[model samples]
Target: MHPIPRIGPTEAADRPRWSVIVPVHDCAPFLADALTGVLEQLAEDDCEVVVLDDDSTDDPARVVEQVGRDRVRFVVNPGRLGASATFNRGLELARGDLVHLLHGDDMVLPGFYSTMAAALDSTAALAAICRVEDVDIDSAPLYRTRSYRRGTGVWTDALDALAVSNRVRAPGIVVRRSGYELVGGFRTDLPHAADWDMWTRLAAHGRVAFVDEVLARYRRHPGSDTRARVLTGANVRERVAAIGVLAGYLEPRRRPWVTRRALVYATVFAARTSLSLARSGERRAAGVQLAEAARCLVQVPGGPPRISR
Candidate 1:
């Protein structure tokens, strides 16, 4: 990757503080609300919203115009670049010191930018994240996520936090542009866990600050990639692949521990996916998942018990 040109304080001051990149794909129904939420929090010329339409069949550009023609700059991709590539395009076009990539279906709360930006600024961390609440298709609150709420402070040991679980939500994360310049964009290869992978990489560079309050709403619907992938048993595979990739980034001595943890996590996750598939009336797929889980257990470094699923 080529080095990004260093910008002086004067040049940065001339640009927006926040470059909110909203990537939309067939999310016309939710675009208006998402844009509204972000537009309301924007501070005059200090923030710019870049709404990129990833060749959505539902004409997301119409929704963007209806919501805020003056507030947002809508760009329609000539061809579908998928999520990671589209987001990387936004990163290239971003002119702000801080970047926030918000999914079109997810809406930020009233004080999300203010709170998260403050956290990053005060802590001088590379990235800041707030607690995210899961919402139904209708945008009604389901439950608040406590993944990043271990405590409200700057976490310098981000690897430790992420090793347990992906505590940061994509919508809730606000990262410095310098971090992206250093770590590069999200991996197009890890579709399901690209965001998790990016966060882990950024964490390796600097601290990640967390806020205690819920600042964003993550819409959980059947159409979402995570839910759809999980239903098809692809989520398990992608998750394991992500764990393997992240394990490679660990220190030599720490790699062994992370590798074992990855296997254990993958095994447990496969079992859970199996149960979910069975509950969803996919008995055959569930059986396949169980077999995979058993295979994962058998593949552990040392031979253990011959556990049958």
Candidate 2:
């Protein structure tokens, strides 16, 4: 069982070790839980909470004022930046060695900060990720993401792990600021798959630590990108674009093989999802997903292998 951290306000240094940046836009309904989660796990001095308000119609700053108790730094975007750009804006404002882009609608589990911090410090990894519990809008657990590793340490096959899809949610992952400096901010074009693209780049270029424990809570609501994007098949198409980004990060010799495998996996997953959606009577959305699956399958460097369940 994870230990609950004692809540304490922080006046972290000008350059703290960790920055928990919460990007908020119309997420004030859940912002208090998000801020309280971070504030509770904040280290005595080396962690800072940065609430980036992306021209939110709701009062995210007020939420920070209450839950963060004026401890979290609140920054308002000059204009309305989309989710990807808003995250980049937060990245620009973060003043720390490690950056965790924790969305304002999501909350972390207890022991999240200390556990991930220790793993990154001990392993010298470019990033660290823990399993996440997927919860409903009411904060009840629906399911937990699968763990890639049993023990806490470097995940050697991290790139291949993310080759097809992104299992890493924002809350469950903390990346080195240096990694961000190297790869730059999230891709603006692939809004649905930008985080996946960024994660693949980080995993390709440097080692990533995996903590078997579930240290974050990811809220799965109807408004989330995954659900909203799937209706238009943007999820599958943007996934292909993200795979292209991943290929660009790899050596020429590894690109074709890795990308082919990724494409095949994507095609298979999309196909399966299409079938499931069709069975559930979402014919139009299913057709879109199926068309994307066919397009993805044809792009496989070599013809896709006969994949069976």
Candidate 3:
């Protein structure tokens, strides 16, 4: 285990060791529950929850007030600053040595705080990520796991290996404050998949520990931005862009494998988009996706790759 660096003044009698940032935007229906889950997971001695209300019109302030203003600091943005910017703002105000980003719709599992902290202490990795279980709008379990291996050794190899699969779920990961700043935090350009992009960048600098146990519940619903991006065909482009960025960071010999994976994933994404459009009775859009898929197949070296189940 590597030595974990402590931050802030030891002289300050009461300071949080970890800062959990929750970026909220009109998530009133689930905001209270999400905040409750976060607060409930932490012992009073471990962390502080900073809720950034990104100009929510749903009266989220009331929920924050109900939760109490002492432990949870509410920062109201002047206008709707989007998720990336809002989260960055919260990171700026964070006082803890480590940081955990929790979405407004997600819930932390029991022992989440203690488990992640222990992982950090034991592995001395830059980030500690646990498995996340997909959940429904009503918070019912969906019985699926998203997990990744602990990244060790050379930073580049760890990053390349993790890049081979998009298994890192954003909410399940906790990062050291210094490491987060080193990566320049999350990029605001890729709004939908910014977390994916950030993870790829973080892997370039230090090791990442992946715990097999599920420590968070990731809610999925019709209104989920993830679902919206996938259904609207935006995720395909974002993923392709992410692959391109990662390819530049990998060695020459590894580029082909990475490119191949990207092509295969892109093909499947196009197929799914076409199916979604067809279901909506938009034959024109479906035809466009089919044409795009055909072009991708032609560019791929050995012809169209078989879509994975």
- Per candidate, the number of residue pairs that clash is 0, 0, 0
- What is candidate 1's local distance difference test score? 0.79
Where does candidate 1 have its weakest 10-residue lDDT segment? Answer: 1-10
Candidate 2, residues 197-270, lDDT tens digits: the string is: 78887898799999999998988787876887788988888788778877877778988988988898889888
RMSD of each: 3.6, 6.6, 5.5
Better by TM-score, candidate 3 or 1: 1
lDDT of 1 by residue, 1-309 (tens): 222232222255578898999998888899888999988888768988999989999978778778886788999888998997788888877889899999999999998988888888788998988889989998888988775446668876677557535777679899898888877887877766778888888787788898888889998886666766655667766766777677656777887666666677678888988998899898987887787787777655555445599
Q: How are the candidates ranked when ordered by TM-score, highest leading? A: 2, 1, 3
Decreasing lDDT order of the candidates: 2, 1, 3
What TM-score against the true fold does each predicted structure earn?
Answer: 0.89, 0.91, 0.83
Quality of model 3 by C-alpha lDDT: 0.72
Candidate 2 residue pairs that clash: none
- The models' CA-based lDDT, in order, is 0.79, 0.84, 0.72
- Write down the TM-score for model 2: 0.91
* Ten-residue stretch with the least lDDT total in model 2: 1-10
